[model samples]
Target: MLQDHGFDVQMVGSRKAGLMHHEGWPGLRIDEIDKKARFSTPRLLPNVFTINAGSNDCLQSFKLDEAGVRLGNMLEYLWTASPDSTILLSTLIVSADKKTDLNVMRVNDQIRALAKQKAKDHKKLVFVDMNCEAGPDVRCLVDGVHPNDDGYEKMAKLWVNGMLEALRKGFLK
Candidate 1:
């Protein structure tokens, strides 16, 4: 998608999954990424990043109330590590598990508030709401947990809109 948009995209991180490098692994929560991303973030200077986290936290039931603070801390660390980078923060997508999805909604609300508050202090933060009725469901997800190919496609579509929004708002250079 970025290539089609004429933007040269270079995915950077420690792990090599398939053909691209990414900073994430399965079952990672916001706090885990907070520590894990440090290793790659400083070495590879990326211009833009898209973050969709907290699902694992909700699933694992680890520090549920503090997800926002953990996310804010992670964002702060990212900014300090690479001041030139622009971050597009996304809300959690729909979950099939009723209990887990409720937590997803709760964390997503915090994420939304965090984005608004952070935007007042930073111009590079872009808020992208990935939550909606049309999002992934029992059919689209793999075992109703991770996104399947179709779910991934939908995720890319959401991220594309956020990327375009960031570009239009001058958050992406």
Candidate 2:
């Protein structure tokens, strides 16, 4: 999607992955400092950083405060690593189960509130509310977790629109 939008995108995604990687096998790959340090201190940093994760942590039944702390740590790491990078926080999508859906909402609310608050301290911090934008459209999601092609297209549109709004608001220069 970013490729089509004429943006040079560098993506890092793992199968069956969450923002918090388990110990033993992979050993905390998602740790904010570990993730940032993996890039080897490149000269050119990313212009934007969009994070749409943490559903797995919710699925693992992590407490709300723990999730919030983990996410907050990540945002702080990103801010310290790349002060000029615009951080875009995306709300988690809908899940299949009602209990999980509620959990998703709780985590997403935590994320949105954190992003808004952090934006005051770090002006580049922004948020894109995927739940509010996409609504309850099952067609936009495959298996109620991940997005399909159509769903991805919708997500791309949402992201583009959000970025455009941010640009207009002078969040991005």
Candidate 3:
């Protein structure tokens, strides 16, 4: 989507797609990402980061109260390791189950609060509300969990919007 907008893009990470390399791994939670992130030097960090974590944390009911703290810790580590980077943190996509949705809403609330605080402090973090913007349908879910292709397309657009928001706000250095 970014490239479609005429911006040069080169994704850098372990997961590879047609031409993008990303850090995402399926089924990983927020704490898990923190524990497994491996950018050991400033040279390895990218200028932009997009994080769509915490779904698994709410899904698995793991340290629900600390989701925000865990995300904050991860952001802090990333900031310290590479101060010249922009992070786009998104709320989880809307879920299918009411119970999971409750937890999803809970964690999303925390995410919003954290992002607001970070913005007030002038941190390089852009908060994307995927839950409302993406509009992933319960009927579009596969395996009673992940979203279908159309839903993913909606998410892709929101991601582009988030990056554009960052660019518009001059958050990228």
TM-score of each: 0.94, 0.74, 0.93
Best by lDDT: 1
All candidates' lDDT scores?
Answer: 0.85, 0.65, 0.84
Q: Write the per-residue lDDT of candidate 2 for residues 1-173, one digit (tens) a residue.
A: 54665655554323224553211122222344335443532333555666676777656555655676777877666666667767677887787767877888888888888888887775686688888756445666677766678777777777887777667667775
What is candidate 1's lDDT per residue for 59-160, written digit by digit as tens? 987888899999999888888889988999999887789999899988998999999999988658888777865556667888777889988878887788
The full ranking of all candidates by lDDT, starting with the best, is: 1, 3, 2
Model 1 stretches astray by more than 4 angstroms: none
Q: How do the residues 1-173 of candidate 3 rate in per-residue lDDT, one tens digit apiece?
A: 88897668878876677786778878889877886674432556788888889999988988889999999989988888778889999988877788888899999999999999999999999998888835676766785579888888888888899889998999875
Estimate the overall C-alpha local distance difference test score of candidate 3: 0.84
Candidate 2: C-alpha RMSD after superposition: 5.7
Model 2 lDDT, residue 137, Cα: 55
Q: Once model 2 is optimally superposed onto the true structure by TM-score, how far is the C-alpha of residue 89 displaced, in angstroms?
A: 0.6
lDDT of 2: 0.65
TM-score attained by model 2: 0.74
